[model samples]
Target: MSRSKTDKPSALVATRPDPFRAAFQQTVELLIQRRADLLSETAINAYVDCDWLTWRGGSLKLTTTGENICAQLRNKARLHARA
Candidate 1:
C-alpha cells in the first residue's frame, strides 16, 4: 500500500518595513506638540526623512495625500485622548 505524503511549507515570504515609519511617527509627534494650524517643512524634515515628505513655497504645505495621512493621525490622537 502506498502512503500519502504531505510537505510542509518550505519558505515564508520575507517582508521588510518601509524603514520610514519611525521618521513618520516622529514627525507626527512634533506636529502634535505644535498643535498649530500648519506644520513647517523644517520641522517635519527635522523628524521625518525628506525622501517621503514633499512640499512647495516658503510655507510648506502637505500634498493632497498628506492631508489624508495627517487626518488619520489626528483621529488616532483624538481616540487616544478619550482613553
Candidate 2:
C-alpha cells in the first residue's frame, strides 16, 4: 500500500510539543488565570491565526478549540502535580 501527500498529514500540521502550540497553551493558561494582559501580541496573533481564538468587542475570546486545548493543559498539569 502507498500513501499520497494528501492522504498523509501535512508537515505544517502541528502536533503535541509543538512550540506554537506550547506558546498558545501558555497564553491560554495565563488567560484562564485572569492574566490575559500578560500575553504578547505575537501569541494573540498565533492563537487567532490558528482559529483557537477570536476577537469579540476588541477582546480575545477563546473558541471551542482554545477551550479544549486549555482543558488538556489543565489535565496535564493536574497529572504532573499528582505525580
The collision pairs in model 2 are none
Candidate 1 per-residue lDDT over residues 2-66, each given as its tens digit: 53332211111012133333345556555457542455555466322332344454433445544
lDDT for position 19 in model 1:
39
For candidate 2, what is the TM-score? 0.61
Instruction: Tell me how many clashing residue pairs each candidate has.
Output: 0, 0
Each candidate structure's TM-score, on Cα atoms with residue i matched to residue i, is 0.36, 0.61
Judged by TM-score, which candidate is best? 2
The residue-level lDDT of candidate 1 at 76 comes to 72
As for candidate 1, its clashing pairs are none
lDDT for 25 in candidate 1 is: 53
For candidate 1, what is the total of clashing residue pairs? 0
lDDT of 2 by residue, 1-83 (tens): 89665443332235435566667777866877878799888767767765688899877889887778777777877998999
Q: lDDT of all predictions, in order shown?
A: 0.45, 0.71
**What's the CA error at residue 9 for candidate 2, in Å?**
13
